[model samples]
Target chain A: MSDLDLLKYTCGRTDLSLICDLIDPGSSVLDLGCGDGLFLRYLKERKNVRSLGLEISAEKIASCIANGVPVIQGDLDSRMEFAADGDFDYVILSRTLQEVRHPENLLDEIVRVGKQAIVSFINFGYFEYRFELFFCGRMPRGRHLPYEWFNTPNIHLGTLTDFHTLCRERHIRIVSAEPLGRIHGILPKWCWPNLFAHSCVFVLEKEK
Target chain B: MLLIEPQNYDFGPGEENALELDCRKKLYEVTLRYETCGKLNADRSNAVLIEHALSGDAHVTGYHTPEDRKPGWWAEMVGPGKAIDTDRYFVICSNILGGCSGSTGPRSIDPATGKPYNMNFPVITIADMVRAQKRLIDHLGISKLLAVVGGSMGGMQVLQWMIDYPDSVAAAVPIATTAQNSAQNIAFNWVGREAIISDPKFDGGNYDPENPPGKGLSTARMLAHITYLSDETMGRKFGRNLQENDHYAFDFRRDFAVESYLQHQGRRFVERFDANSYCYITRAIDYFDLADRTNGDLAAAFHSAKGKFLVVSFSSDWLFPTKQARALVKALLANHLETNFCEIQSGYGHDAFLLEIDTLGAMVGAFLANTLNEVSSGKQRGAQS
Candidate 1:
């Protein structure tokens, strides 16, 4: 894909701004499920962050390597063998946590290797998705959840509250969190987005 | 640019004390020493500084010291008609600042304190090492360099030189190196450091002068050596092959040929290299974050670099892999810099840049000749004008 197209697919609008604010220049970063590695390349070019990407698709890894973003092809469900403990300053799991088979294990691994972890996922508890399931009696499909129910990779659908509860149970402290939607552009904080927004983004730190 | 035959003259072989140069605050009054293989002239444009890898020394393509039986580490690449083409380029290779050669290192006495610096030496970064080289370049009265070239740690210096002094070099070739150290790499370095510190003889990086921490250092080298080779290369070369007989000897008595090879490498390395130098140099590699130096922009690092680049990488160099080389190319391309890259297929691992004889030689010689021709013709046109 072209650089512009890839950037649009990877960063969207909200994710890019969030990544910019969270990632420090020169920080060693690990990007899990780094689709096309657009975000990592952007960070590397603009911020000087040393980024390594982990993606399951060989085609995506090839694109990443061609762009000079280091990437390894491997399943996230398996143990991460390439990185050691406390290797990166941040581990990003953008739009990927719900797709994995065992997100808890992956989260644990992310915490083990990085000081902070940033997770962004489509919140199934969003009002439209809930309404579609309750009244329409069909799985919701839209800009955020674009995949069909039968072929979707997202197996572990979770809500904002479920994610926060999981983080608490794992003793991972939520450093910051934001709910994202079209309305967030006007009122980002006042939009009680757990049941209204399309997605949720969170930054968690493992307690020392 | 002056072009001279490679074997025309000699750099004074006498053991002169390390001379200090007045480089700006970026560097200290470090020793600058060099051995030359060709005529020394005022233009100094023919001079090529050969940065050595970690654990390498000033002897680029010559006999090893004391035990002169073995040839230099890069004899295959640095001699006449070799990849580096010493015949056309007046090659100058020095042991780095935190090195164990005749240069000042951890073992060298601190003139002010009258004691070996050891672990007490200030933690050095890759830029600091390049700054020392810059001082040496100034001491030689060289206005600019033909090229700065090396592999692994040497490659790190090449990158640092281009970024730190963009105007000083005409071309740069850094092989088998990444834009910065990876997490896996940091872990390996940490393990090596831990191995050195945990040794009983270490004494907290201040071992006795008479009996250094050879065991710990040897182990560290052994561990690092494994990463330097590819699985395919090792499998083809050694692969289930016993030391001598087909059966296993069971006990840890160098049963495998690979084990014997590693043991010999470790033993020979300890004799010439200092443990503290290893610690310091590895630390420098760890701190090598190119983005950090350029205010986090990879493209910005090359914004002022007017030099042409020919970055070569080997397919099987897992340590610093071809992917890393491509990253550098991407940044250079982003900055609209003149560049050429070739990921030559080879199973020699990170050492492929050194061992892929004919391929590396042809690529480097052709690139150098083309750049030199352009430079010479430009000068001729200027003269006419």
Candidate 2:
């Protein structure tokens, strides 16, 4: 069974399943910032997809090797020199977009290497973040944003509407957008996603 | 703390054991010094080949005796209950073809001439070293190796092994090495070689048998030692601190602690290493470029290599940095081979593999165990079917 199928049986989170659903079986995958290769292992076992992973930590790379996952140690901020153009069917950057040096450049490289890219990140413009900034007068620290102000990797945090603008700006076609959490899932189509969504996932491909 | 002694295996019959080097010059009657800690299994499937880097010999681990000062070059990693684990796998480490220790090199007496080969020694390459080891393996009656593990120049041999005899290797761990020697690495080695050559006592690598080129060889080692350590590590170690004094001596004597350290290291190195072998080995390493060998197509070089690969590099190693390792990984991935690459963050530079034993041990140990299991499982399936 694939990770999606396993998660389905185990009552796992909806967002993870949604991301797996976006990918077709037996497709080539490149997972950026693949810590411990958890998702790649799942994809390999369930979807039977050809997968490669890039991570930065040595310990995590060892773990990936131990699990028989082909992983390369590299920083996400650097250009995708190892990955060839259109080499992968799907490039995943789940919860890593906010931590990247330049999200737009990274997304461009991702879409260049992969036919499509699945980017999932915690929405900075969400109600709780706004509440923390407004009421608490500090950077948000909750379930989604668990890190402290100094150590948090979320440098370029954006919301769903900002992503829509980015997609339009870059002439990228949005295949699908899935919102997660109690507030984000129930938001009306006409309403602003900035105020509702706690976390969001967007699958994008070039207009061509 | 437990030291083990190494046993030598000498075998040669002139032309019968001839090795043709890259330069097409055949070296006959070669003496390969080797040591095996663990026993060979019934099927000989659990044999691990450990290749040593430059300046390293067959004494990979274990002391000559209980009271011996140094156990081995890689004493920390390849011992009983250690990363290599003599308890599980039969480990074999041999001195390269052109090395000083007990191997036949420039210092060895040529059977035909009845004198040390010296300048007459055949110019050997990394591939030549692997070819020599292949003979040793055949003599041991081991058809296949569980894994070929090494760092730096040793890693070059691992790459040569995979490409030369792909079917013979099940897995490879090439740490702190590139697919080929970079221009910078070549340039650094060139400077070290120049140090030895420019010495007045070098005498065209045909120095007097009684007293070799000490000054030149020591100077060459001192220059090469700088490349092994990072600036940060050097600073942490010595940082301009005066040697045996609170202030500068303002004379020709070794002023800084770093200078004294280098002098000590250089002086100690010349005693064990042969200057002529240094020239041959460095030249051999400089000539190592797998890409050039395959007409600039690196991925195609591994066309027949079906083994799993683990390529490692140190972050601070400017000589064999992460960039080089990543390029190798990229080529392997391009060939659609199973590969794992990791750039370990360390203050130690190119010498991290030798220095950082804890992390290196665990990583190598885990990788070896996983490979051993896969090989056994495949054999089991083959037998049952």
lDDT of 2 by residue, A1-208 (tens): 3545566642544556677777899998988988877778777776878888999888888788777677888888889888788988999988888888888888788889999998886788888889989998998898777899889877887777788898788888988777666633534545556777787788888889
Cα RMSD, model 1 = 13.2
Using lDDT as the measure, the top candidate is: 2
| Predicted model with the maximum DockQ | 2
TM-score of chain A of each: 0.91, 0.89
Chain A, candidate 1, TM-score of 0.91
Candidate 2 accuracy as TM-score: 0.91
Task: List runs of model 2 lying over 4 Å from the truth.
Answer: A1-12, A125-141, A147-151, A183-197, B1-17, B379-385
* Model 1, C-alpha of A40: deviation from truth (Å): 33
Compose the digit string of candidate 2's lDDT tens values, residues B1-385: 5555555556565666677778988887788888888878787888899999999998888777777887888878987889889888888999999898888899998888898898899888999999989988998898889889999999999999999988778889999998889889889888888888888888888898568788888888998899999999999999878889887778998889999999999999989899999999999999998887689888888887878888889989988988889888888887777778888889999999998888777778888888888787774212111
Interface quality of candidate 1 as DockQ: 0.02
Clashing pairs in 2: A2-A46, B4-B62
Encode model 1's per-residue lDDT on B178-200: one tens digit a residue. 77777788888889888888889
